[model samples]
Target: MAVRMEELRDHEAVRAVNRAAFGGGHGETVAELVAALRRDDPGALSLVAEEDGEVVGHIMFSRTLLDAPRELVPVQTLSPLGILPQWQGRGLGTALIRAGLDEMGERGVPLVFLEGDPRYYSRSGFEPAAGLGFRKPSLRIPDAAFQVFRLPAYETWMTGTLVYSDTFWRYDCVGLR
Candidate 1:
């Protein structure tokens, strides 16, 4: 099957993919965030994986700000990468991740942050943010689960408590921790 990056249409179909992928909790809100980001910040990267006119997977990157020692710095956030259960082992998630990173890299996005499985995200070059002076704003989150990927090199410039957009807070991403 071919994987391509394109603007996501068919809101209901995207929602269905999310519902099926996450069993009503995660997917539904992730789908909604995708639409909301598109409406509010159309430039935010929203990509979908389609095969035979059906969306099998989705990944979202949105604007996020880092609270640096001096001031708030803008960065892209990679989150909520969801793939339908049936497509779990097919490497669609990896492809979407690569596409997202490549797109961000080309744009010179300084950093990308995510909260996910260390074992899996490590393969994509993510490391614990705290190790590089970045700390999670929420003391509740374990330091290990919060990770960052700096394009050129990890440095003090990227250190800060990550501030995600409001849409992410609307959903319960407990599974992320």
Candidate 2:
């Protein structure tokens, strides 16, 4: 499978993948959130995993902010990574993530944060954000779920609270309920 930047033509496939990956009501919620993010966050980084011209997976990274002491540091947040149910365990998710991170790194994004399974995300170079002196935007986020990947552009001074975009709150996706 090849991972690449998502194009306008892949929107429906991306939505279908998200819905299939999450399933039921939760899938619908994620699908809606992704649509809203696409419309609201202009800086969102969206990637798709395609095989034989068929899009089977999707991932998104949105620009967020770090409330640092000196200034608000612009950062990226990875969320709602989805692979079609049949595509799970094929490493498409990892490929999309690595591609997204590489793309962000090329753009000089210092840090990428996400709320996910530590065991899974750690393989992609993500560590607990708290360990790096960054606070979660919500108390609802579990310690392990709040993870970060420091890119080459990252600086020690960038550590602080990660402020997610308003769309996340509007979707009630800040963290576990």
lDDT of 1 by residue, 1-177 (tens): 455665435556667777787675655676677677777666788678888988888777888888888888788888668788998888888888888988888887888988877988898888898888786756656778888888853356667778777766665442343
- Residue pairs with colliding backbones in model 2 are none
Clashes of 2: 0
Question: Cα RMSD for candidate 1?
Answer: 2.4
On residues 1-177, what C-alpha lDDT tens digit does candidate 2 reach at each position? 888888998888988999999899889899999999999888789999899999999999998899998899999999889998887898998899999999999999999999999999999999999988999999999999999999999988988899998999999999898
Off by over 4 Å in 1: 8-10, 153-155, 172-177
Off by over 4 Å in 2: none
lDDT of 1 at 28: 68
Query: TM-score of each candidate?
Result: 0.87, 0.97
> Which residue pairs show backbone clashes in model 1?
none
Each prediction's Cα RMSD? 2.4, 0.8
**lDDT score, candidate 2:** 0.92
Q: Indicate the TM-score of model 1.
A: 0.87
Which predicted model would earn the best lDDT?
A: 2
Model 2 weakest 10-residue run by lDDT: 37-46
